[model samples]
Target chain A: MKSFNKKEFRHGLKRGLPIAMGYLPVSFTFGLMAVSGGLPIWMAVFISLSNLTSAGQFAGTNLILMGAGFLEITMTTFIINIRYMLMSLSLTQRLDKAMSLPKRMMVAFGVTDEIFSVASMEQGTLTFSFLIGLIIGPLIGWTSGTFLGALICTSLPESLSSAMGIALYAMFIAIIIPPAKKSRPVTIIILLCVGITGILKYLPLFRAISSGFRVIIASILGAGMGAWLFPIDQDVEKNNKQEGVNQCN
Target chain B: MQLERAFLAMILMALVTYIPRVLPIVIFRKEIKSKYIKSFLQYVPFAVLSSLTFPDIFSSTGNLTSAICGTLVALWLSYREKSLVVVAISAIVTVYLTGLFL
Candidate 1:
């Protein structure tokens, strides 16, 4: 209870509201997919509650439904969700130095792609309460969407479910657009990475590669290229940190 | 038997995913000093998300037109800085309407 910081908590909850809305249609589709694949509604909700990573959960569910080997499930999930490591690292760079170890671990559980993107753009050093508030919206939305999706998939028409499929990608594109326009390096990195992914996806040899590995390799290469060409100025970093500390006070 | 396997798979999936997210935050509590690593992290989201969005976005729905139109609308809205909820729901509606005609 003492952990609650009302102002930051309110801020985070507000921030999370949009993310929660975005997660609804996407996770609704995930629920439909899950129940069709033979998961019980509760189990689908359980997965949504426990594993917030969308791509990882989809792959893991596919395997589990197939009765794939545990080693396979683990290995597949590791490959798919490995990008979160990079995201977490980036967010750690963005976090307040005073944010504690226990707090870091707690928020780490909620580090989905959308959450990380939104949090990384925060202007100030993060407080645990704000972080919890941020995590809570998506957590509830994802779980409830799953429950509703599983419950209603049998009842919904095919066209409706299919239309919902595009919501996640639409949200991702929405997230990147502002930053892409604001930063030249980001624009170039996005173009280069999308091109690389296209090559990997379409070319005969690389088409066989799993999308998980493709994302990992493409992401690292894109970031590496951006780093090589357009490193963030140290003056800027210091300035941002100064602003963050000032905001903290 | 199947349920047990699914349960185990869920647990394992949770563990592996959790480790990746937790490890980096716990290991790097101090301020990062390296410019290269910092830059890499800075650009990771754009690059990863760019790759994630491509090709996949174009084909997520049944018809190409629905995906393409919805994506175009989303790009336009988000560029104008619409709320994410607005952007996503608008695109969803766009696709739904497009689906009716297609």
Candidate 2:
């Protein structure tokens, strides 16, 4: 019910720019895949508009293409997207405690991996406007990229588009490394995650686990291990303490 | 009929996906009090991002060499505390340029 905060929203938009750019190629590929798989162009675009997810949309659309049943599609999407629960829970820690339920719901819709990473690592309490601003650019990029890909059907050269694949991961690196530099705990946790994930991916014994499950196992083990090995000092964890008192009237 | 089925499937997918994302934030309005749990949540971002990056990032671009090249550039720029756009753009360009050679 409050007036929108233009400044924070602008900052969110600026921060979201890279994420938007990163989504372009991925969503573009999604559009191309869905349409080429025989879904109508509107359907492909609708999926991007409604879903705003990468892996889940891809998996779901793939199932749809194969004429998989609704329950099967639903469950597969859920498993692939279960990681968002951790992300949303983690993000709740950073959000302003006073944020209203509707506002919380709005921001929750935007909790993609890239958005969560950028917002989570952000320096302080996140305002609703800032979160909205952060989400809009990437949302537009994702939908528009889907539209373009579905419409054009691969005009960009393969090399250029394929190179864009690293953009989001690159953005992920940009989010984590700075914090890792300042905190030994952060550095250790990151290495722990990388090592575990690498093993899960490459080990023949664990080869049966899907990539989505690999992320979940690695994240839980890595964070759980960090919590045990390097319990943070309570005082140093006051990043959200000030905002706890700043509830809106 | 197929259109109706696909639409229904998408709606179902959206509902299931939204549930995981929305439930925790809505349910846990009160801040958690446990230190251990708080620490776990705190470390979640780093853990998730790192996990998402490794192995996957190595296979992100055209090939391993280009991906490595892009990853190193991203690491170097971000180590110096470059802005996200700068770091991202630099890495993309790095990958693109590296792709040219291969």
TM-score for chain A, candidates 1 onward in order: 0.92, 0.87
List the candidate 2 regions with Cα displacement exceeding 4 Å: A1-3, A239-249
The collision pairs in model 1 are: none
lDDT measured at residue A92 in model 2 versus the true structure, 0 to 100: 88
Global CA lDDT computed for model 1: 0.85
DockQ, prediction 1: 0.69
Docking class of 2: medium
lDDT of 1 at A225: 93
Candidate 2 accuracy as TM-score: 0.90
- lDDT per residue as tens, model 1, A1-249: 355689999999999998999999888888988998998888999998888879999988988888789999999999999999999988887666777788889999998888988887777677788889999999999999989889987757767777888888888888888767666777899999999999999999898889998988999999999999988777875564344311210
Q: For each candidate, what's the DockQ?
A: 0.69, 0.62
**Stretches of model 1 off by over 4 angstroms after superposition:** A1-3, A237-249
Candidate 2 lDDT tens digits, A73-164: 99889988898998898788778877988999999999998898778656678999899999999999999999989997755687787788
| Per-model lDDT | 0.85, 0.85
Residue-level error in angstroms, candidate 2, position A236: 1.0
